[model samples]
Target: MTTTRTNKAWASNALAFATAATVTAIVTFTLHARVAADETPNSRPPMPVAQTQYKLQLSFEREQRFLGLIQAASRSQIGFEVPGAISEILVREGQAVAAGSPLASLDTQALVARRAAAAFDVDRASAELELASARTQRRAPLVKSGAISAQLFDDTRLAEKAVTSAFAAATAQLRALDIDLEKSVLRAPYAARIGRQLLDRGAVTQPGSAVFTLTSIADREAHIGVAVEQAQFLEVGQIYPLQWRSQSVRATLLAVRADVNPISMTTVAIFSVPADVEAFDGEPVSVSLPRTEPETGGWLPLSALIEGERGIWTVLALRERDNATLAVREAVEVLHVSGDQAYVRGSINDGDLVIADGVHRIAPGTLVAPISSSSVTLAEH
Candidate 1:
């Protein structure tokens, strides 16, 4: 029994040893296979990129389009001088009117009757004054000759003075009535167009009540607001082209307000338009300011620039590495971006060979074969 038990223990130990050997061989083969796979050449290598060198451009203009409105150069609100119910409105909105043309009328029947009564009083007072003058002359002669009592002569002089005073008062009243009669009719103060009608005929209006709004047709303006930086470029008397609804017009810079507008936080610029150009108040228009100052930068195609860390930009330039063409990165600061072009300055000097496209396929120190871009349009200075 002891011999049989020892023989079974030996067989068990041999099985354990064989099993350990198989596991060790498997682990060793796996490690060697991984190392060999890493050392061997790749079956599918990266294809060589067809690269292009883009030339640098300098001197560009910065322009921004702004929107504004066409407005009247001068506006006036018309009102009646005397309080009365409006009797007639003779002018229509948007109608051109000459100076002194009647725009509206107030009821003048009562005023006219008073004016007639004043005229009649003036005529009667004139006849009485003539009779008083004759009596005063006759009394002067009598008082000097002592042909009549002195008291009677004094009474005659006093009567003459009283009648003369009455005559003067009546004439003053007549002159005042004539002025009121003329004011009953509202007339255009100057040659202008009716912009708006506040009240219709028969509407009761008080003195100084706005009845119509008039805008001068001979002068028009473009009222636009711009940032403080942009305002510095504008000068008084400078002419600029303005567009509205496909219509183009030229306007001369009339004024630039020093105070900033509270609502838009911009400075106001008023440009006087041509008198013949048909424009209305508050009509929207567009204007572009030509930059007089040249900016120091170079323009590159959009494909040449790459986004970098912290909102910075980068470009891959071709350089010699390992006796082969390799891409090297250069930092650039984008001054302005227009459409598919980027205007940049910094790090990238003039005549740098920057990759125009396929930047994603290229990395720093990447091997490449660069060729001149025949089809790409290079930016001009």
Candidate 2:
């Protein structure tokens, strides 16, 4: 009977121990599940972020400027008016010369001889005219006194008239020779800068042969070739602002060619440069042409742009709640993009939040943590 009682006590003790073990297993699994549920959503580390508020102000659109070479106003190929052997070159290359200054001299020996011959001919003609007048006066009285025949008197009168006409012709020839002699000494036509001299002393040159190149820099004009598409918008007498070498100047549109160049398909627009700008006859310069007036638009950092199937896009952060930051993808119209910023127009307002940072990783409806002002880089376009 005692052995039977020990067996019952052992069985009861074994059952109680098994039940306690099962209870402990159930409690441990419940605690583990509760801990896992608490940690799963908030386990990830927070992302680094930068935030910026959009700015609205009267911002001038950055103008697009083009480069052009400076050029002189007028260029002329200076040469001798008449052909002769070159005797002396008065000016050297790269010399500044005044208007009408002697540039070169042709061989004046032959010209001088011709001039002297013409002068002698004029003197001889004058003497011959005096003699003929005297002869005519003396013969007139003889004819009236019947000492000479009427035919003889008429013949002598005709001879005197012929000699008078020949004298006049010889005098005119002398004047022409004198003018040619003066032209042998070449003189500059205008105040100009002289280029390379083609001939030295004793070199024979033909008429119209280039002796030197002369360029007038006074009242220089800037000639630029504008593309045909752009040239069509330009009008005569329009004033365009220009900047050259950090100097501000105004250029007046003088004229535009009606036809475009076949090779370049560009039309020529002539702009009269100010007298003080100091430009050379063919030196190029930078030109700033105003296409249209400035229009109001929203500007954003260039980093905010995201490229995808919608082409270039930007993420606009909408303030859903005071503490929660939500971003939405929006298509924006880019008007002018310049240096680290873009002038854009879109459905969003000027003061809207633009996602400049964290753009590559975030998508539409992304929850973002807003960074403080110290972390954001804000720059004006």
Candidate 3:
């Protein structure tokens, strides 16, 4: 009976130990699940990204500036009228010359000889005419007094008229020689800068051969070829703004060609540069012409433009209540592009949030978390 009682006691002890272990395990599991549930929020959403838009002015068409060449007002190739050996060269290249200044002289030996012969002829003719006049006067009185024959008087009168004609011819020859002598020396025709010398001392030059090139820069002008379509917008006397080397210059349209060039089909326009503006011949410059009235337009980052099969488009992000987001794709007409800013007209408003960076990665009606754009750091290439 004692053995049976010990067995019952052992069985009872084992049952209590098993029950205590099961209760401890249940309490530890429940506390761990509760702690995990409290640490994690089940319905948290991401933050939305912030975007920026810039206000811009819109116009019909932005003015375009074009490059052009600067040129002298006038240019001429100076030459001698007579052929002769060069005796002297007075002007040097790049020298400033005035009108009527002696530029050079040629050997005048032959011209001087011809002039002397002409003067001798004039003197001989004058002497003959004086003798004829005296004989005619003396013979007229003799004929009246019957001291000389009437035929002799007629001969004297004819001789006087013939001598008078010869004298006049000789005088004209002297004057012709004088002009030829003066032509042997070349003079500047106008104020200009001398270019390369074609003839040097002792060099023989032919008549009409270039002696030097002269260009006038006091009043400058530019000749430009304009297309037929653009020619219609240009008019004579219209003022246009020009910029060169960060300097502003005003140019006036002097004239426009009525006929178009057959080869290029372009009209030629001549513009006079302002006198005070500094420029050089054949140097290129930039011209800015205003085409439309000035007004404000919308400006957006160039990244916002999405070009696809349908053309360029932009995505505008809209925010709604309950932190919901929506995007709308709209067609945009780009007027002009300057640097990274694009002037466009579309459904976008001034304060509207347009997808700037990473525009091509997103689509319309996409849910986006608003995040600070400044927080994203771009790696430098």
Index of the highest-lDDT prediction: 1
Work out the TM-score per prediction: 0.65, 0.69, 0.67
TM-score of model 1 (CA atoms): 0.65
Error of 1 at 30 (Å): 38
Instruction: Please give the ranking of all candidate structures by lDDT, highest first, separated by commas.
Output: 1, 2, 3
Stretches of candidate 3 exceeding 4 Å from the true structure: 1-59, 65-67, 138-151, 262-264, 291-335, 338-341, 345-381
Writing each residue's lDDT as its tens digit, candidate 3 over 132-243 gives 9998977887999999888988988999999999999999999998887898889988777898898789999888899998887577787777666677888789887777
Best by TM-score: 2
Preferred candidate (lDDT higher): 1 or 3: 1
Tens-place lDDT per residue, model 2, 70-139, is 5667688978888899888888888888988999988878877887888888888889888888888999
Candidate 1, 1-381: lDDT as tens digits:
999999999999999999999999999999999989876634324335444454454466766777788877678998998888899999999999998999999998888899999999999999998998898888888888989989998888888889899999999999898888888899998889998999998998998899999987777888788777788989899888888779778888999999997887888888888877777778898777755336666778888888987998999877775566777899989888777888887786667677888888777876676764665675543
Q: What is the lDDT of residue 345 in candidate 2?
A: 68
Model 2 RMSD to the real structure? 8.5
Q: How many clashing residue pairs appear in each of the predictions shown?
A: 0, 15, 15
lDDT of each: 0.82, 0.76, 0.76
